[model samples]
Target: MNTDRLIAVLAADAAPVGPHVVEWRIASALSIAACGAVALLLLSYGVRADLAALVATPIFWAKLAFALTMAGAALVATARLSRPGVAVGRVWAALVVPAAIALPVALVVLWLAPRDARAALLLGNTWRTCSLNIALLSVPGLIAILAVVRSLAPTRLHLAGAMAGLFAGAIGTAAYCLRCPETSVPFWATWYLLGIAIPTLVGALVAKKALRW
Candidate 1:
């Protein structure tokens, strides 16, 4: 084929792309997913009975801040992943910083308590259920996120899926916070993180097949 003719053919078939479009697409999809998750949570587990009192405590807000901040970071990462030729760079720092800060703080909180009380801090009554619930809640958000990512030109499919999963997990964790009665930072830092990790791992594994254009 002549060079000019080949170039023209390629250009014609290329997908249209724009700056920051990924952010909006993923955000819109996740917002819809959040509504679905909330409805599911309400219908299934219902909100905590002491929600009003829990909201008054500092720990409650701290737990939310950890999850929401992770969501924001993952969203940024997913946005970067959705586009080709984009350098993720320090955007990953947003994810690392919160966990780095909170985990140590949680450990300290546990250490300062009486030795016998440490187990309670680590394993709260819901440890077995917490991660599973977070993963389950993340399903709707994960599907929504993958839909948006699949529409884009993500070069790193696995990373894109992982970030999307992280985003979904964080959102799910935040929603779970409303129903969770545990007040220990150690419990949240451990179990909640495990919850987020489950989907992240799954996303990484399935991205090649699921995100193919």
Candidate 2:
């Protein structure tokens, strides 16, 4: 086949290229930060307790850090996929590696702890509360992220999986709030993290494959 025809065929098989990577990254970062800000605001103005202590705690900060890091990593993968000549399979693999390592480690750590300690770890503090708060704060932020991703990425595969994962996380968080009593940081730091972060990471990985053109 001629060069033009060959190139066209290859392009046809590739994922739809959407927005500039940098812009998407910035938008995602801003959305996450906004969520955190809203969470803090709710804690201060709406909730009964002292926001200062909750925000200051190492556990709360750690959860924030983890969420931000995962979001950042997903954005990076998305950006990398925007470049020409990157394989979809390779991008998916890149996204999965860290997650595979982290998931097992998190599970093992939780499993190894004594039963009472584990329960205490998962149910003791403001995890459920913060998760509910975070989930509530996340709704608008997540919607914004979806809109940005749709506008920029526009690929059906990426959009569908990402939105599904996001919706699932939001719903799960809501469910946890209804059923669970404890709302501590450790509770969210464990089960809640797996619930939201895992799906999000999976969505990002899928997006890398499906959105690439």
Task: Return the top candidate by TM-score.
Answer: 1
Q: RMSD, each candidate, Å?
A: 1.8, 8.1
lDDT of each: 0.88, 0.50
Cα-based TM-score, every candidate: 0.93, 0.50
Residue range 40-93, candidate 1, lDDT tens digits: 789889999999999999999999999999998888888888888888889888
List residue ranges in candidate 2 displaced over 4 A.
Answer: 1-57, 78-114, 125-133, 159-186, 194-213
For 1-213, candidate 2 gives per-residue lDDT tens digits of 999999999898798656565565545645564654455445543543454656665645544454555445545544433344434345455445444654565567678888777777665655546544544444454444444444444445554446434433443343333233344444554656556654455555566554444
TM-score of 1: 0.93
Clashes of 1: 0
Best by lDDT: 1
In angstroms, the error of model 1 at 59 is: 0.9
